[model samples]
Target: MRASLLLLAAVVTLWGAHWPIMKVGLAHVGPLWFNALRFLTGGLSLFLVVALLGRLRVPPRRDWPLLLSVGLGQMMLFGVLVMYALRHVPAGRSAVLAYTTTLWVTPLSVLILGETVSRRKVVGTVLGLAGIAVLFNPLTLDWSDRAVVVGNLILLVAALVWALCILHIRAYRGLSSTLELAPWQMLLAAVPVTGAALWIEGPHPGDGTLTFFLVAAYAGPLATGFCFWAVNQLTARLPAATFSNAMLAVPMSGILFSAAALGDLPSGPVLLGMAIILAGMATVVAAERR
Candidate 1:
């Protein structure tokens, strides 16, 4: 009810803000360790919650591969790749690009998934991209800067992998609830993340500083764990259009949280871009309402 919505909102806000907080956190922790902590802590926390709620259950063996794909794609590919990419890019810029994938997902859904593109959805996609351009276009390679090249490339790949993961999940309509799959998938996904942290991150982990612990815990438990659980719970009752449409607010919240967290200022063009994006989202919401 009210509490669940607040939890989801808090989770999304933290996740959006995590883009910047991670920039600071990653400085102290290596890439693998950062991701390892993210998945491990959140996975374990959700494991307990799901178990207590009696929602943890494994699908049949035939379905194992697909479930594992979601885990690997999300936890290993998207999570790890973003961590590596963030090493090279600014937090705010990376946040903008990470979300800009709405543009890619729309067309891909049409071609690959055979989902028809309503004009409102198309408008939403275009405006979302325009917003991204305003927010992040200048952050790209310039006349003098080449340092973030690797990071930017990795982020692009991460976004595509995420779309793939999301599309893969969309193909699954009989999961009962996404929460029912979390403990299993998180457990399955943890094996690789642990090994990667061990092999790639070297011997040390981050010092248990107050800031590090808080940010890391929030990203894993509140953001990923509780958020996904909430998604499963809410979507079971709400219309897909209603549920999906709520995502339109995420980028705006991300930017607002960015300004609050980092004291980063959005330029006039960026603000205008955000407005256009909201207008597009409104169009989609309007169409869906009918």
Candidate 2:
């Protein structure tokens, strides 16, 4: 249990830190191309590791529905929308908005998966959403600006897409382990993303900077590949609402990491929102421990 908690911590930290790194990468590459490269690199790395372990195999036909749902909806569509939105959104704000998946996940899990959520978890989710609302202060955004409005809306849609995928994962009873199927899922996402990048953006070899490569290494192998596996592993063990609420920590940490890496300092409301979010996550953790 201790080890699982540690792994979860590591997953959250790596995922949080990746937000700022992605901001850096977007400076040197187009959004779609960067997303395509990320999925390709992540897929290749996972494939190599699984092959070395002699665990790689073609996904059986039974898993195709899940593969397409997660690959296309969660990974491909979510990645594309977030990347495009990130171009206009601040990394910290973007992180906060993107993680609203928890809000959508709780109700969906109960309705679709027939999972019963504890009242504590429900309250925690509400608190976390309240924090998100605080951080999302409409007063701060220039409502007249189309790019800002559209970008924020896109993030919300991405969150909803991700929430649906999480429910599918919880409901899945499949022949392959999550880790075993991860490479194929990534590959499935990569193919169309790469094609879209080529068709729409028309590739240019990135600025050839060391920073770009470093971003690729972190976002691909560690964030996308390893973190995805870690998340699924935990997801299988925890209740859906509990798991989703616990993930509220991701935005809080993302904000801190963004401040550190990108110097995107948080204002008073952001700090308050982070505190509220932390309290909400703590509430969920306490409920789980009981």
Candidate 3:
């Protein structure tokens, strides 16, 4: 339990940091190209790691459904949609909106997974969502702006797509361990993303600066590859709703990371929102312990 908790913390931290790092990467590349490169780099890095560990093998046939589900649904579609949205939305706001996955996951878990969520978990989810509302503060947005409205809507769709993938991950009854299959899943995602980049954005070469490569290294290997693997590991260990709710911390940490990296400092409302999110996460953890 302690180990799982620790791993969850690490995953949240990496994913939180990824938002700002991703924004930096976008400066050097088009959204689609950047998305493609991120998956390609992540897939190759994980493949290398699996090979070095002598654990590399073709995924079993039974695992293909799950591979396709997560690769296409979670990694590819989610990444593409969010990247496009980020063109118009701020990273911190995008992080908060994208994690609306908690809202979709909670009810879906009960409906599809047939899991009984405890009262505490329900309360925790509500608290976490309330915190998200605080952070988002719809009044601040220029709703009249078409690009921003569309971008925000796309983010919600991305969240729903991610929620569906989470349910599928919970339902998977496959042979290969998640780590062994991760590289292949990422490979599957990379193909379509790269194709889309070519079709939509043309064959334009992106920035080749040393800084771009540095950012790509972090975004691909550590954030996308390792973080996705860690998340799947935790998903298998915890209830879907519990795990999803706990992820509310991602945006809180993203806000802080953005402040440090992008100079988008958190205001009083942001701090309050972070506190509420922490409380909500703590509530979920307490429920899980019981």
Evaluated against the true structure, the overall lDDT of model 1 is 0.68
Model 3 residue 45 lDDT score: 91
- State the number of backbone clashes in model 1: 0
lDDT of 3: 0.89
* Residue-level lDDT tens digits of model 1 in 1-290: 46645755765676777777777788678877877777777789988987899766667766675567667876677878887877777676676666655655666666776777677766666666676677666643663656587677778787777666666666556534677676566666667877878887776778778888887877788766766556445544433333344454565676777778778777687688778777776777676656
Error of 3 at 140 (Å): 0.9
TM-score for each predicted model, relative to the true structure: 0.87, 0.97, 0.97
lDDT of 2 by residue, 1-290 (tens): 67768888998899999999989999888888888888888889999999999999999999998889878988899999999999988998898889899878988888888888788888888888888889888789887989989999999999999998888888988899888888899999999988888998786736779988888888888898888778877877788887887787888888899999888899999988888887888888888898
Prediction RMSDs, each to the true structure: 3.0, 1.2, 1.2
Tell me the TM-score of model 2: 0.97
* Candidate 3 lDDT by residue in tens digits, 86-189: 98999999999999999899898999889998899888888898899999999899999999999999999999999998999898889998899899989999
Q: Please give the range of 10 consecutive residues that has the lowest summed lDDT in model 1.
A: 236-245
Most lDDT-accurate candidate:
3
